[model samples]
Target: MPSGAVRMSRKRAPEPASQLGDVPERKRVSWGILISQGSWADRSPLHEAASQGRLLALRTLLAQVTPVTKGCHANIATIDHVTPLHEACLSGHVACVRALISAGANVNAATFDGITPLYNCCSSGSVGCLELLLQNGAHTRARHAHLPSALHEACKRGNSQCVESLLAHGADPDLKVPQLGSPLYVSCLHRHADCSKILLHTGANVNVGRGNDSPLHAAVRQDSRDQVTLLLDYGANVNSRDEDGRRPLELAPPGGPSQQLLVSFQGSPRTLCQLCRLRIRNVIGRSRLKHLPRLPLPPLLTQYLEHM
Candidate 1:
């Protein structure tokens, strides 16, 4: 045997709950070891096998564990207030999630901080977990501490599948939180083209800028021609001013490829946001009305403004 290592001839089970060190009282538990040992759900042989990805073991556990435990929503050590189902959903273990849900696990159970199983999957971009949660009646519009809706996560990460899934299930694309704005705004700020497109198609306010400005301003700042065009085509105002008296056109970086100045219809800086909305809505409305081809700016709008 090596000087520092001891080799055991027999396999050993993990430390029992009682023999294990003290379980701290906080929030957010790690199901890693419990899932690793396969008995995290109550020392059931089926749980052990399921933890190991044993399909038959999972089926058997789904049929057996609940009957024995009477569908108890027990905590896994690492997760503060989350049950085994939360861990499964957070880890994207679809089968395990299904088993837990089938076993009467509360799909909407939240951790102490308001994190939910759906939030975990959404933040991680796990479509499988998302679908599982949705199918099991998960709250599609649920919010959590420090996190917006799952749609916000999907938009921020540019996860098309999750966005589509959430929208199809009636998740409000226009939903807003203090930290993250509308899904369209988040997508625009992050330059997530597909996600932004999806949000626009789903009736998100393309012209409604987030925070101090609109999506047009965000696209201009990033000099994202594609995103800018998409926003414009979908009804974002090109002339909308923010709190700083800067129009989306004025905020365009040193390089961009579109220049169109539609003065605020109301011609009032006090209502600049509304003016920008109107101009953008009119442009987009006309385009839609006439079925015009997508317009591509001939040169960066910033450079054009310099000449004017």
Candidate 2:
């Protein structure tokens, strides 16, 4: 046991008729006795089994215990309110997660700190778990006081697959978390070019400055030429300034790619084609630009429009 971790004593509760309706008559045993027999960090057997990806053990445990309702009336939680579904999703155990959900676990249950299974799965780069949870009607835009959204977590971890899954499931590409800015900013800061590209194509604000620091500033600070180019293609302001009034050009290292690109953008005027693309995107709106590739245009032109 860890020094500060609390070990709670388990107590038996009456089984819900709705859950036990399918079971045949037999000698009733206290489910709490099975959970209390081990010093397993004060977590129930279902939590331990789900975390370990033990499908058979999870099924047996679910058969014995009452199913969790949508309101989390019967789901097991640790001292911090971390549930079995949280454990399963954190470990990327798809089968265990499905079992728990089929047994009526609350998909949107949050811990004491507001970390849901979707956030945990995204943080661990578990695209399978993410998809399953979304299919089960998990809230895609659930915000946490301290943690960002699942899309932000995927971007921070550079998990492009998870980012795609989150975006396809209706995650807000521009959701700004306190101190984290937006998903695009986090992706640029970490040099996740693919993630940043996805955000931009999915309608993230190109000029959403974080405390006056534009994402272009973050790209320049990280010296990611690919990210910088992508941002500019999406109409990022070249003269954008940061909190200390430092422009991206000033932040770029001399003789680096970012410096050269910014200098070129400053000197050269926009071409007619570039202006047209920007105008079309603006008129279509960021929310609708995601369908640009599916429009009735030539594939090459569509690729150009999507910045592919």
Per-prediction TM-score to the true structure, in the order listed: 0.63, 0.82
Tell me the deviation in Å of residue 70 in model 1.
Answer: 2.6
Per-residue lDDT of model 1, residues 85-187, tens digit only: 6556545678777777777777787765466777667655778978988988898866543544677877876888889888888787778876666778788
Give candidate 1 misplaced runs (Cα > 4 Å).
Answer: 1-68, 73-79, 143-147, 258-308
Candidate 1 lDDT score relative to the true structure: 0.61
Report lDDT (Cα) of residue 124, candidate 2.
63
User: 54, model 1: CA deviation in Å?
Assistant: 6.2
lDDT score of residue 33 within candidate 1: 30
Error of 2 at 176 (Å): 0.6
The 10-residue segment of model 1 with minimum total lDDT is 4-13
Candidate 2 lDDT by residue in tens digits, 1-308? 43533222222244567755653221122122332343446677788798789999988877875434332422689776778898888778999888889888888888775678898787667888989999999987865545547777789878899998888878888888877888899999999999998888887899985678889999999999999998998889988788888889999999999999999988987788888888877788977887887788999998777767
